[model samples]
Target: MKPLDTAILLAGVPLASPVTLLSGCVGFCEDLARMEGFDFSAVGAIFLKGTTLQARQGNRPPRVVETQGGMLNAIGLQNPGARHVVDHILPTIQHLPTRFFANIAGSTVAEYGEVARIFDDSPVDGIEINISCPNVKEGGAAFGSDPKVAAHVVETVKRVTSKPVITKLSPNVTDITRVAQAVIDAGTDAISAINTLMGMAIDLEKRRPVLGNGQGGLSGPAIKPVALLQVWRIHQIAGPRGIPIVGQGGITTARDAMEFMVAGATAIGLGTALFRNPLGAREVLDGMVAWGQRLGVANFHEIRGTLNQP
Candidate 1:
């Protein structure tokens, strides 16, 4: 099947395919774009690395440690800040074939608003509020873990930008639906579920935590089950409200993307898999086409939320 034949829309943004490059993995899209056979048009969207109001040095050494099925990372939202990205990066990449989404994070609600406002005036196709970041004013508690805080961030950013606001929800919560509902009520245009779960590894030889930061977000195949469940749950709540879901976590192949779509994800995000293969997106799109052909699925949307239960 043709790539366009498998196209799906997310929050009014037309994706050539349901596959998208997750934030923090593509390095502003330049990394994969440089790959020999990488095709940006094969994927639906590209989420740039998380950007804060100001530049962050990120955590110390040993920020990433590989695990059995995934890796642990506490990169600390390292970036060149919103202003620099707006001035330098976006201009160079604004002409890419696919939609570009800015992933913005901040320590305070006002800062999140400021970043969103900056990107709003830029050429980005949308804004994804990274509410999973620790709220400094709230004693390092993640904004995504609390419905109120998450809602406030969404409300603040929505007030400043006309672009679609996609709230990236954290998996480290009791009832993911509560947070999803809160953000939707606060005017978020869409939801991206299951940001890496917080976790850590240990160095048996050194007798210390593996990551420089005591804890890091766990991502890759390990979190696929958890992410699938979260996407399904969020869809149960937001899907009825006309809000789309970006299902991501441990997605490495076409089968993985199909599982997410079948569970209710309108779009799938590929992150950790990129580390293993820069051209993973193209392969995923191919797999989806093959799968669609086998199942006689004409449109990719047909498989969404089609989970069978007795």
Candidate 2:
């Protein structure tokens, strides 16, 4: 067992692993199921691709481009909609070794609650409200950037489902910690800190934007500084209260993982790097294990909140 493998208690449910693979684009139908059988042993669980009420084809070509330290993607939020995911993806993953956390998106508050209620009856372990998807026109950025709307969405979904709810917040706000606290007050089981930061790239040669959407969510190592700031802030304010913080955004190595832990993140999520190398997720996990051994820590939990000062 890895050092981070101490049993995790979430709303009275015990989880075997603390590492979760973050994804927003699992293929259609049995594709997710096949991926699960082959990769489930590598991590604690997988957050399947975000699904919408209606299927989306996402953005146009050149939607993705490589940047200085990290890559930028404008893949949009393309998925086969909720009905197809339910009939096709859920069945295959329901029996995997790791639990399934479904990320649902929409253009309105009602849509968030509507889709969450469906997962309540599925074999899902939890629902992660992805309110920070920049490619979408309706729900994502609108809900996440506004503290009142962010809290409202969580409260509304909580009323409809018993599943442990995780609200993924946006980093584009003026005050990230304030937004994090908004959802906490709304009663979320966990707060997934530091979603991709909003950024743009221009093609000087053509006098146009790089992505079809004109702008895209900035992910990877470039945003690590901003992401670290947000995660640390949440740690300072929320850690003592027992709320679990799931850190993401620009984590590429075991040391990066350690920073999140020291910043008081309970768990870490891997996103953009997975596209560059399929082994990205496994490498991070293995690195953390190796780091723990060198540090002479028996259980990784002891490293939590190492930076907080009373």
Candidate 3:
């Protein structure tokens, strides 16, 4: 049998590996790249911290709280603004071995467009529309919570950048497929299923929320089931359309990554797993190759969307 081929084309961009270091966890991929055992070429791509039109101070103190099987974070989309990232930061790491994507977020539809427009002129390989951010113009309700608002955000960003647009959906909605269908109609090149679920942690002594922002996004092993279902459902909508899906949420092992691939994720996201093991990407890649060899599968495509449903 032939050796397993992990390489793939994600929304027209060539990816040497299916493992994509997710946004916010890898942080520009600088420090991690400089680590002793880190291999930039081992992963397909890395998404930078969420960037907005302007710099943000982020949320209050105690932004993260650890839970039983996961963690809650309310970082509040803190970043150095879009222009600064495109002008200063992109120049530094654009030459890295792996592709880089700008995860853009904003409080309004226009802000997302402006930010995407900025990155559009840069060397970033692609753009990820982070609709999980609150729409300040609409009384701070999350943009991903409403199908129409999410579609509007995607449409606005799609108009500004020619790069592949991957819309990240939030799991806090009643029906995630509605938002997926809306963005698909709005012309997104790909989809990132199941952004962190909304959750809160309470302080026993203080008698208040553990996170400073009152509520935070939950991620880790606890959310794997939710993430899988979201990816499967989104794939049902995107599969026939030829739109790729980047599956994420609480993947820590190679088996976990394989599960995502079989569920219809063309590319697997490594997020919270990085916090526990910075070198998890390489480990997962090796394990995937071994699993493929054992199963006599030569590539990820064979494993993708092969779930046997009753």
Backbone Cα, N, C clashes tallied per candidate: 1, 1, 0
State in Å the error of residue 289, model 2.
Answer: 1.8
Predicted model with the maximum TM-score: 3
Residue 93 error, candidate 1, Å: 1.1
**Candidate 2 structure lDDT:** 0.76
- TM-scores, all candidates, are 0.97, 0.90, 0.98
CA lDDT scores, all candidates in order:
0.91, 0.76, 0.91
Candidate numbers, best TM-score first, in rank order: 3, 1, 2
Tens-digit per-residue lDDT, 1-310, candidate 3:
6699889888899999999999989887769666765687678999899999999989997998889899999999889999999888888888778899999999888999999999999999999989998899999999999999999998899888899999999999999989999999999999988789999999889899988899999999999999999999988989999999999999999999999999999999999889999888889999998998999997888898999977
Give the per-residue lDDT digits (tens) of candidate 1, residues 109-220. 9999999999999999999988899999999999999999999999999999999999999999999999999999999999998899999899889999988899999999
* Model 3 lDDT, residue 138, Cα: 94
Model 2 is weakest, by summed lDDT over 10 consecutive residues, at 25-34
Better of 1 and 2 by lDDT: 1
Against the true structure, candidate 3 has what lDDT? 0.91
Segments of candidate 3 deviating more than 4 angstroms: none
